[model samples]
Target: LSLHPVSVLVLKVNEVSLGIEVRGEDLAVALQAEELSLQQLGTVGLWQFLHGQCSDISFQESSALKTDHIRPAVGLRFEAGPGAAVHSPLATQNGFLHFLLRGCDLELFTSVLNGLGPFLEDEEIPVVVPMKIELLHSRITLKDDIPPIYPTSPGPVPITLAMEHVVLKRSDDGVFHIGAPAQDRPSAEVPKSEKRQSAKEQMFLVPTEEAFGQLVKELPTLQKELRETKQALADANQEKDRLLQEIRKYNPLFE
Candidate 1:
C-alpha cells in the first residue's frame, strides 16, 4: 500500500564514474542533484549517455572529473527553497545533493522518513513523497544486517546519494520544479524527466518542414536503391543456379 516512485543515482570514487541505477521503492525519496551538471544525467535520465560522450564542456575538460573528490553528505530530513523555473530570468542556481542507497538499513531509512511526513504529504492522494534531502556534512549509518561492500568501521559510514524526479511546470509560471507541488498534476501539463544536463548537452530535434520535404523528395531515390539491391540479389542467385546446372551436366553419372 506504500508504493512510491523513487529514483537513485550513485557517484563513487572509481567503481561508478557515471551510470543510472533505476529502482522501484515503496517509500518515495527524492534527492536533489548537485551542480545540476550533465554528469548527473547518466544516472537519472531514461536515456543515458557516458560522461565524455555527451556534449558537456565540463566532461570534455581533462581536469574536470576527479574520483577522489569526497562528496558532501546531507541529513535524512531537510528543507528546500522554492526552485526557480527553467524559463524564469531569476532562476540562477540551486545546490543539490546526489545520494546512493544500497546495502543499507531499511528500518533505519524508514525511521528517517518520520521527519518528512509534512513535506511528503500529497493533497491529491493519500501517499506521501518525502522532500528531497540535501546531505551536507552528514553521514548515513547502515544496518548491521547488510554486509559491508565498502570498507567501514564497526558503526556507520558515509556514502553518496543521487536524486531523480519528474520536472513539474508551475501553472502560474512555465518554470520547471524538481519536486512535486501540492497542486493538481493534470493542470501542470505532462511532466518531463528532471535530469540536469550541461548547456552543451545535445539532443535529437524533430525535422523541420523543409527537411521533411527533402526526405519526401528523396523517397524515389531510396525506392530505386532498394529495387537495384533486389535485382542484384536476383542476378547472383541466377548465376549460382546456372553454375550448379553446368556442374551437374558435366558429371559422369549423367553420361
Candidate 2:
C-alpha cells in the first residue's frame, strides 16, 4: 500500500463539542495471497485477518485542530493480484480484482445550539441540530480479470463490471437523495431516449486483444500524419513572413 499525501484537521468548539476533518491526494492499496484459507473461522475470520494485517500501520504527517470542514479522498485504488487464492469456505475463484474511486468531494456539518430564546421567553431550550452531508462528482469502478479461452490468444483481459458517477446529498431532514449533479445533467431540450442512451454508453466497457493490436498498428501512421501537419504549419508561417516583408518594402511607414 502507498499514499501520496494526506492532512487532517479537527475543530473544537468546546471540550465536548468537536468535529474532525480529513483530506488526502492519492491512495493505492494492494493485496497478494498465495494460499488463503479461513474455513474454520467462517466469515468473521476474514475480517479478523484483515484487521490484524492493518492494525499497527501508521502514516507520518502534520495535523492541526482548527478546521470545521472535511474534504474527500482523491485517486483511491485497490487491487488484488492474480496469484491470490481463496479456500473452500468463501466460494470465490482465484482471479484478480481492481477497484477505483476518484474525483470525490464531501462536506458535513452539525452542531448543537439554543432555540429562539431571546425572541421568545427568557428560558433557553437546547436544540439538536440536524447533520447534513453532501458528496459531489464521485466516480467508482470495479474490474475483474477474464481468462482467455483460446490457446493462440494472449493472457487474460480485464473487464469492467461497474463504473459510474455518484452524487448524494443528505438534507437537514436526514433523507438521502441520489441523482446526477445539476451541471452534469442533460439539457432540457434533449430527448429522453437520447439521454438514456448516453447513460447506457457510460456503464460498460470491454477491451479485447484485436483492438489492442489495431491500435498498435495505427501508431506509426498517426505519427507520420502529425509530422506532415507540423511541416505544413511551418511552411505557412514562412510564407506569411515573406509576404509581410514585401509589404514593408512597398510601404516603409507600415511599421
Candidate 1 wrongly placed segments (more than 4 Å): 1-211, 252-255
Over the stretch 1-255, how does candidate 2's per-residue lDDT look in tens digits?
A: 133211121221211222121214212243211111111111123344545533432322111122221221221112123212121111122221222222322121111012122235646652322221223233222222233587788754433222245544333344555666444676984445334331221111221355447658877997999899999999999999998899999998886
lDDT (0 to 1) per candidate: 0.33, 0.33
Stretches of model 2 off by over 4 angstroms after superposition: 1-215, 253-255
Write down the worst ten-residue block by lDDT for model 2.
Answer: 34-43
Q: How many pairs collide in each candidate, listed in order?
A: 12, 0
Backbone steric clashes in candidate 2, count:
0
